[model samples]
Target: MRAGIIGLALAGAAVPVTVAAPQATTVPVPPAKAPFTFQEVMVPMRDGAKLQTVILRPTGKTGPLPILLQRTPYGVPQSAPSQVPDSYKALMKDGYIFVYQSMRGRFKSDGSFTFSTAVHPDDPKAVDEATDAYDTIDWLVKNVADNNGKVGMWGVSYPGFAAAVALADPHPALKAVSPQAAWVDYWMNDDLHRYGAMRLSYATDWLYMLQHDKAQDSTFEYDQYDTYDWFLRQTPVAKIDQDYFKGSIPMFTAMLDHSNDDAFWKKQDWLGALKKTTVPTLNVAGFWDQEDPWGSWQIYYKQEQNDPDHLNQIVAGPWNHGGWHGRGDTMGRIPIGTDSGIQFQQQIEAPFFAYWLHGKGKRPDFEARMFESGSFVWKSYKHWPPRGAVEKSLYLHVDGTVSFDRPDAGEACRSYISDPDNPVPFRPRPISPTYPIPDWRLWEFGDQRFVGGRPDVLSYKSAPLEHDLTVTGELAATLMASTSGTDSDFVVKLIDVYPDNYEQLREKPELGDYGRSLNGYQLPVAMEVRRGRFLESAEVPHALTPNKVIAWNVPLRSHDHVFKKGHRIMVQVQSSWFPVIDRNPQKFVPNIYRARPEDFVTARQRVCAGSKITLPVMAE
Candidate 1:
């Protein structure tokens, strides 16, 4: 129920003219040639450092038009140059200046770039981006003649992080910002390290790739190829040191040194700095965005609670990290069935600018919009999911059942053996040529389904559903069991099983029913995993008492889905989720970073009637 912006194309120009603009101020438009003109410009930072920027302007002479800006460490040319043919053409044709800038020391920007360097109390580089962003905005508004003296900022992933930093010291011209899939706290959310265990493959590979000295001309090609190869190899990250990871090691070391939520992580927390944001903000996240979805939600909620007048809108969709990929119509594995991407620009993004920058339309109505997965429906709410929803627990039963009612019958438990040496590989099959870094692209549906039938995995399913059920909210598992060995790991998975009779109909006419349809549907739906170790707290490692029962709570990421009548809800429990999560050696060791093969041993894992996986179920 959103209103779309309709613009009239200038007689011979590419820019679309605003109907409500003053007649005297309107510029003569030319025939549509291309959406925007691209240029490379050097933006000066507050500290005198120069950052490279890619500018995209509507293809005609127009009065100071509103600006849309994005700052990123990932090179801008990688995707910004060809935006016309890409899905963002609507935004370009509608008359807005697009600016993409490189962060300090990254790509062609002048200055040393270090990941999370700004989080360090002593790091000057972190402060540089903020001041530099403010300076750049000031300069853009004054120098760019076409600029309307108002700027709106937007970016995904690392670029989103930069956008958040820019708002910390916003320029006078900057008025609206949208940060999607942004990484707020590197330690708690990012791939490098989750809890205390090392995310070996992803961290190592990422550091190895980003380690090259960009300053050395001779190292360019070598670094690119080496980094590319490392991503394909999927090696353990903990072993990488200064020898292999040059400048990048410092960031990793810093993350390791500050395991707790000390001043280090707090400095990087954009949520803590919510008071600094004065502009209208739109935050976007995805249910499957394994990297920073939680961070995005946290930022939006914090901002909404802190600032009542500021128009803050949040959109949560069913997508992985960076899944938007500049596309306006398509999302992840599904096509929008219409020009949904263009609709988003004309209806959502464009109007947002009109209201905030141009002072034109009514303020956005809803505070948050979320796309429910499995159900595939979009829901709008004044605030986040209702706070009235109580915390209800669904207990795990002995005979492979999950129920809301606690067991009054005798207590029962199920046991499985966990061997770290023969750990469950992350994907279902062997990924011999795995990426050294944990890239979602490397592990697709095939990879995740690979571990489905392993002996170490214990699966429990509900009888074919008698009625449709929808689950929405954060999920946690409380286990009351003991380990036969000193320490062990426990893993949980939530899966949606498609009915056996369900058939995928092909939409592609050429391939007929056999040909894959671009608009095809997936039968199995979705699945998620959480890894837990008995001896270690998510923040710290504690020695496990042999044969002693202890309480452990494992939290799975948030999700929304519908189990249609006859569809099954399956819960799988295991000790290890290989490759994605590193193997716990079973023996209590001080540092898993340097564990020997001999340290791994087989241990008994139990899931009894007393132990249960609790799910937050929403009444249909």
Candidate 2:
């Protein structure tokens, strides 16, 4: 995957020179007969550190040209190759110059680099990124030929974060930007944490593998693949800390230090600083992006409300994190059944850049675009969720039922015993070579067939629908129940169940079958789990009295899906989703890292009938 090559090239310190020369990989570059000349240059930062940059200049004898820039920690190709045949070619062929720069402390650049999460200690909200980008543009406008002074910027993921930073105090030449899948809030939902619970496996593995350069003699190294395998094979839950996490990356320490959404997080948030941008933007995200989908949508909403002239647009697809990069494949156990990557990069992403960078096409018609998952079709709206969509609640009924219709009788509650010692393992399915772990960690979609029948899993389902119904927008589950322990965790899953004709298989080709032949598919669409102690507030830790029910709200992100006439809507409530989410000690503990086996206990968990899952329904 060339995963370590970029890091090694960037580190440039005296170490094992085992890495091979950079590969001649193609990255959608423009053609020779094309209107632009592609060249590599090093752009200097304000601190006199040089950043590697790739510049595409318009062909002709003239003055300076307008610039389209992207600053990424990901490497910039030493030379730009021709664009891929199957992808969109408009942006490359257009006259505007394209620029990609390696961010400070990365590839061929001088400076100490830390992931954006650690930026607060070194620089202000957008100081480093903005400075680097501004300097790059400043150099391009003067040095490049056939020039115009205008500039635009765009990127996805980390680069997307860079794009957001570029706009903090933008360059005079910067005109527009599209920061898709960009992160605004780090602690709340980016890779490190989810709903105040630390994601131990992904966080540790990512930091060790990607962030820490071995040249630094960092005291962390794991057989990335085997370490997780061994942990999963262990007998009980308590051994994981000592076995895999001890002396590793300080991930647990970072997690414990920021237990709440406090000043520490606010200082790093990019959303507030983004209002300073005075140019157009197109924010993109996927409905199921497990990493930072909320941040993407939130960025769009905040921009539109705060800066009316910013030309903000949003496009959300039925995808998981980074799903737009590749063709449709199974995410864990569920199949979304489409080439979301091609659809996004070719149709929405390409056009956005073409329009903003070259003024070459019509502005996209819809203010917001989203693809409904089960129905497998794209829909556009005047605004996010549209004006008339109403928030409706589907109460969790007793006797294993969930319905939008209110319960006509007395309050009823379903109960299960939660044992942290034998906490439910996440991604219980087999491992895949492409992923870091073997379990369904990448598959955020709910698939309950594995845990449906377990005594600890409480399942509530609705009857087969008589008509097609489309649900669009955010979903939340409000549980008005209690636990029988000092502390516990609650996991909620919303699923769509297809009829028995729906077949389940493991291989890749089986994805095509599940998409076509399924008469009904009971696939989990959205779910969330929160620690009971953090329910009241992540800042304050409150212990629960045994068997006392407390009201809790678990908000799942937005999703667009059409449940066919014969399909049923199901909601699964449980106390734990282990490995993926760390086990809640079931007792109030100072930190999960310090939790002992004796702290684990079996507690009675309940979901009362009055509790419900709320969905935003767009009236026909």
lDDT agreement with native, every candidate = 0.62, 0.69
Tell me, by lDDT, which candidate is best: 2
Which tens-of-lDDT digit does each residue in 265-291 have in candidate 1? 565555454563478888877666655
lDDT of 2: 0.69
| Per-residue lDDT of candidate 2, residues 1-620 (tens digit) | 49799888878877666987787988896646644467877777666788778876645525444577778776775654444334324354554566778777766767756665323223553346666777787887787766677787877788887886666667777777888788877666766677777666566555554445523323344443443364444333334445755544444445555566667666667666666337777787867676667777777877777665547778877776656665554544456677666777767776776676657688765687886777776788887767767888888888788778897677668898888666665654442322333333355664567787789988888998888777887788888888888888888888888877556555666546654544444577787778777777776777888778678888887778887777899888888876666667788876655566676678889877678888888776
> For residue 307, what is the lDDT in candidate 2?
60
Q: Residue 507 in candidate 2 has what lDDT?
A: 65
Who wins the TM-score comparison? 2
TM-score, model 2 to reference: 0.82
Candidate 2 runs further than 4 Å off: 1-38, 56-66, 82-90, 117-126, 214-252, 328-340, 432-442, 502-520
- In model 1, the runs with Cα more than 4 Å from the true position are 1-34, 78-85, 117-128, 213-237, 242-249, 253-267, 325-346, 388-391, 432-439, 442-449, 504-540
Q: TM per model?
A: 0.81, 0.82
